[model samples]
Target chain A: MHASLVVSGLRKVYEGSGRRVEAVRDLTFTVDAGELVCLVGPSGCGKTTLLKCMGGLLTPTSGEVLVGGRRVSGPPPGMAFVFQEYGRSLFPWMRVGANVELPLKQKDLSKARRRELVADALESVGLADAAGAYPWQLSGGMQQRVAIARALAYEPEVLLMDEPFAAVDAQTRADLEDLVRRLWRQRGITILFVTHDIDEAVYLGERVLILSASPTVVQEQLKVDLPQERDQLRTRVAPRFAELRTHVYEQIQAAKRGEPS
Target chain B: MTDIPPEPTRPSAWGSLPLRVLFVFALPALLIAFWWLTSDGSTNVYWPPLRTILRTFPDVWTRARLRADLVPSLLRLLAGYASAAVVGVALGTVIGSYRKVRAVCEPVLEFLRAVPPPVLVPVIMLFAGIGDTMKIVVIASGCVWPILLNTVEGVRAVDSVMSETARSYGITGPARMRAVVLPSASPQIFAGLRQALSIGIILMVISEMFAASNGLGFTIVQFQRGFAIPDMWTGILVLGLLGFLLSVVFQLVERRVLGWYHGLRDSSRRSS
Candidate 1:
């Protein structure tokens, strides 16, 4: 059974240094098993806060996140997070293969089985030959692929990505987006991707959840009706894609202007 | 990744292996040559001729003397250095990991660190007595501060993202410390170790000079008092040679342990 991720009435407030700011005011959403969902918002909309709370990296001030019906007080067993800062997330001291295999060391798998999973994950991410190379030896895009490969090797049921491609160049970002879609289709791993890029959310997800600016709440959830077998060239240029992106873009602008959802 | 040029893992700034070796040895060779020529036949009462000191080297550092002085001195150095390293890293990790521990320990650590370790030789001897225990404790007391302080700084500076990444992946307890904390802190830790090596040698000699018995420092002081000028110079030379040899070994070990760190730094430097 695929594990579905649930976040209900999640609220997070940062309290420190005599200042209290509500980062994620109220967020309620459910990403069905094997489904890909993208969260988009204005720059200060607390998409990261919401994602961190859901991933159990940060404690919510209220409500709860559930993966496969089990409440997450801390990082849940079936979940994995792909940080936006791949350069920091990866251990510079470890080679690509070792970085990928690190998470699996905690699992019940044998050493041979762990190696097999590492190889398969690297092969899937088009980084099979980079196993011996350190993370800094590769390009920014390749480093991110290694990070994704690391998550994949863990065989996690729920993958949470926090604007993973934000630091790469435009061309590399496109390639990574396609890589995510391909991996999602092949593996059927439930993914919750967070980004501020409206077009990226439209191009990648089955559904896009847009968030309001700071002290955030879900502004809207728009269904992406593009055919399942989508590609960069044709799908992006489709009339429906334009309408959907424009709608999401307008909603983000409205959120920035303090308009009610 | 392949498009990137081959990394210059060793510093290639000078170019060519033979030339690099030449550059490394050039200054030391010139200095030694100057010493040999200047101190050739002429001799002061205190400063013997270079040839006299060389001749006395075989006589003064015979197998018997080496066994009595050099071997015990080295063993004590090794024991003290090993203990300092273990305690420094262990205690430093705890202090660095916890704010309350660091807060309580900082003032005391700073006060103790500020006191010159050689001055504590008499104080340590009072407690442990004039024996191997006192010498090892003296070496350890001096050596631990650099290592402990450096480990604390290194552990404190471990990147937050790396910590979060480890935590998210279910790497906890000893696994987390091994896979994440230690490696992250090791570059600084090695720096501390490098500093401690020389300090350990200094303390070794200082502790020996303070009191009774046979050791390299004790032998040197005895030669000086008895006016065996040439033998004294030989003892000084042995200490210098010992320091040089230990340093060479330390570098080899460091190269192996921190190969990845150097590679990472070099690549980052080139990219930026």
Candidate 2:
């Protein structure tokens, strides 16, 4: 199967005022069409750098990222990113509905079509009544949901989420994880989700790509063999789930200790 | 997980509705009462009694004077203020958005801003002539500085995340500026506008006082020159009233335009 997104030999070095730091070094990965891939790593492992490079928000020092077979030098079309900081990502001045509809205005769609898409997106996120409410008026979890609805409304072929549930409570995080899985299954859109939580990586992703510490590279890729249908209660307590999470956790500990992948 | 948290309610710093109203008007009312009591039947020439000024107010500001003086003055003020707002916002957005432009214009802007605007009335008159244009130009010149400078700062301070979000979604050019940039920078822009309004008023009266046949400032000068002490006092009162009225109107517009801003700030403050 052809890959929908490809990162080849991606390297990003920050050089400023006579100080140099290599954030991401020689990273290579791929996400096939309709695949849900999670990227996990130790803190400061440059997951954000890789994601930004893939999303075309940041240019790689040496190498290339291809989305839909086209090289990404700048933010490419039909791709959306959900930042960890939802408070900053969402425009506070816009209402929940307007925030979702903002990107749709860029597409060549009729007003009725745009309105329909916005309504459907909001409804999917269970925020249909919050259309007129400003983002800050809602709770942290609800605001993040609005951000997701915005990405959904854009009808993106590839969605990139960077630690999207990091700031929410554990219960809300579980609910949002389910929401993501459900949406991915329903829409069949490719997603590259980045996180540092081992259990979350094991739970949400079909395949997990673990990275080494700073000046990072992919340490390992482990596929989940658990049942396809996952629930917060049962799947989490399953013996196989425990085993996979343990392997991921140990790999991350080794990475942090500077063991070569 | 099913229900969202309720919106936080803001604690009122000022108590009940009636008490809040009283708090707002108490000082001004006390001052007015003191003036009325102290100035009752005064024999002073320059400081006429409060009743004499109030009585002369209608006679001095008759319908003819309203049309000939007050109307023209306000029209010039409106034209100058509107022009200043447009030019200030336009130029400020450009200057704020580009680093090179900001660097090149910073020193020149600082120097220009330092020179008191009233001092420029003579220079403006030389170019705009001793007509309404001169008065309008003078007002606009003073008003533009605050609005322009504030706009530049606001534009510079636009949130990076929001800007990146706009770009990632293919929202660019004028659409991005209008939807993302301008709204993000509006709070600072409004602050500048508030400052410019008062500056606009000051420049209006000063320019009229320098050279004009009829205006609030001109009429006040005429009254002083003709020894119409009560009439002069009334003209001053009219100027004060006009400024107060314009400020109230500006506050209403600002509240409407910045409702989201206030709501966001209040919510964040309460949550934190």
Candidate 3:
């Protein structure tokens, strides 16, 4: 159950083409082992860039991301990423089972063991029946599930998701948000999800990190202390939930106004 | 997901089926009909009515020398195309993965592809000898660029996010290419191969026609030299049929390889 991820004074900037744009500035955050933290930010606020830096997909200008107190020189050995564009994220040519099995192949697991893990992952995502199907053969929601299954099958200690459900319809997005909550609670995996949606962040995260406009720094941190199990309707109406959402919403507005909150 | 705009599927409703079928078949049918009308003892050039050409197919097919020529030509095409697939795909993969490799090779390949295969026919015939090897080289060299360029297109076209996703999983080095890059790039790769297949066929006939004393090209030239108009028409018809058949075969394979993508788009369209 030990799955803490620590990001310390991380700074990232894009410097090439003789035009430098700083993306993340002195971003410091820590997710306790098995905690779910949602990052809510404005567009171009570098939330995704921060996640990319944490996931080692982009190099940080300085500082480090540590998984279990070990510095991440590259993608952490036990980490996974789920992207927003599920259609582009999953390999269309691969069957659902094969796509899920891809990251597992890099593991030392035996073929039978890998099959078992893949089955478990797909079943967890309620996609066991689609093991033989290809990603393109599924709906956008289902394609995203295959992507989740791909990450799950990797047995990552930390899962980094960048707007995973943003492409789906409203109903599908709600359903996926619930699915993610279930996994977060059940597995206690360290989850860092980045999204522009405030309600989604309020709904799923145990903690929400509000980021400022581009050249992003942490605007505020709000702990979600609502009931552990959440339903979209009931939770959205909860008094504490409204209070927290309002606070995050105000912070975003302040960031937009370029005012300190 | 991705915001790529999809092409509309051809209407397959009952009313459209015949029209669609007619649309595809119309041009060739009209050409054949025109040939029939003009060559029916009415015109001197473009000799032989369509019927005379059809009648000559069997005689053309069964000739011992024709069998020898056709078999060798077909084998040469297969070998050349296969060689092109291997070398082109491999080189393209490496070039596609490395930016420096792509930059260095892209210009050279673009220039080479512009030069038609016929230009190389004489050079190959001189250096490799006027043998099967020379024709094979001619076809291979001519066809490889399409496959290579397509492979490069396919490989480069692989979504950057997918590669990032793979890298974020600690699936580095060769594993990343096989698992992520290759499958993602496959649709484009298949496109290149299909283009190469047709080019391979065209190069096959043209190379033989240029330098060799063998193959369908040789037969066509032999007919022309002997002033046998119908026989020459028969050779052209056989080549057309062969080209059409190769194209059909590749289409079938393309559908199979990209079946998932095709099915998904259809389903999405239906749902929408």
Candidate 4:
């Protein structure tokens, strides 16, 4: 059975120096097995806080996140996270291949098997020749590709990406979007992508979960009725793509206006 | 827009290697030449000619007692510095990683760190006697602070996102420390080591000067007291050369160990 994610009433309150800031309040969502779900929200909407809660990086003030029916108290074994700051997330000291192989070292895999996995992941990301190079030597897009390779090499059941393409240029962002879609289809790995870009959410996910401003809740979860085989140019210009984009865009605006959905 | 500037030409072959070396050694060579020329015929009691000091170098250095003193001094320095390095890194890692440990030890460590090693030589001699043990203890106490404090700072400065990344990947315990934390903190740690090496050398001489019967410092002092002015000059010259050689060796080792950090920094600098 494919691993699914269930974040139930996940509320996160940051208490510091007698001041309580409720980041995510009573938020509930589920991403089905093998599904590509995009979480789109306004800035300061606690989308990152919610993702951290789901990944078990941050403990929720109340509620819990479950992966494959097991509550996540710590980082779940089947999950891998791709952080927004690719520069900081990937180890600068390690070569691209070593960076990809690092998480696998924790697994009980043979050295040869780990090497093979790193090679395959790098190849899949089109960074096969860049394996020996350090992350700092690569361009921003290439570095992010290495980050993706690291996540892919882990062979995770659920991949959590926190605005993975935000730092790259438009063209590179489109390329990465296709890369994510291809990987999801090829591996059937469930993905929960968090982004602020409405168009990106529509272009990438099967369903887009819209989040409201602070004391955040799921404002709406819209199903994207686009074709499975999505292309950057063709899929984006499609009538259905525009409709889905506009729908998500308007919902985010209304949510930002503090309207209760 | 202004016209583009022409590209700068590379230096000539002579300028690249031969001239570069000449330029680097020019001041020292000139100073030595000046000293030799000025002291050629001097008959002053205290300021003996450079020739006499040069003549006495072989006499003092080639003696059987030279090995006896020099070897012991080097061994003590090595032992004390090695012990300090191991203990300092271990304790520093513990202090840097956990908040509780750091909070408890901060005040005590600071107080101890403020006291110089030379100052402790007499105090240490009282407890341990005027022996190798006392000398080593004094050297270690003096050298440990730089390494310990640097390690603590390095470990504390590790990027939060990087640590989070490590945690999320299930890289915990010693594996995390070895792979992520140590490497991240390495540049700072190396900076500490470099600082400690110089301090260790200074302490080595100071500790021996205070109590030990034989060492470079003791030998120099002995020559001075016995009115062997040329021998005293030779001793000072040998100590200077030793310090220079030690620093050169340390720099080579540092370059090898911190090659990755340099490469990363250089590439980033070029890109920016």
- DockQ of each candidate relative to the true complex: 0.64, 0.67, 0.51, 0.42
What is the fnat of candidate 4? 0.52
- The full ranking of all candidates by DockQ, starting with the best, is 2, 1, 3, 4
Candidate number with the higher DockQ (3 or 4)? 3
C-alpha lDDT of all candidate models, in order: 0.91, 0.91, 0.84, 0.88
Q: Residue A100 of candidate 3: its Cα lDDT?
A: 89
lDDT for model 3, please: 0.84
Per-residue CA lDDT of model 3 for A50-92, tens digit only, reads: 8878887777989889987888877888788999999877876
Candidate 4 Cα deviation (angstroms), residue B106: 1.7
- Which residue runs of candidate 1 sit more than 4 Å off their true CA positions? A1-3, B1-8
Candidate 3 local lDDT, B248-269, one digit each (tens): 9888988877776676667668
* Candidate 4 global CA lDDT score: 0.88
TM, chain A, every candidate: 0.97, 0.98, 0.97, 0.97
What tens digits encode model 2's per-residue C-alpha lDDT throughout A1-261?
Answer: 789999889999999999999999888888899999999999989987888888788888999999989999889897998988899999988988899999999899999999999999989988988888889988888989999999999998789999999999999899899999999998898998999899999999999999999899889999988777899999999999999999999999999998976
List CA RMSD, all candidates: 1.6, 1.5, 3.7, 4.1
lDDT, candidate 1, B114-187, per-residue tens: 99999999899999999999999999999999999999999999999999999899998899889999999999
Candidate 2, B228: how far from true, in Å?
A: 0.7
Q: Clashing pairs in model 3?
A: none
* Window of ten residues with lowest summed lDDT in model 4 chain A: A1-10
Worst 10 residues of 2 chain A by lDDT: A48-57
> Per-residue lDDT for B180-234 in model 2, tens only?
9999999999999999999998888899899999888898899999999999999
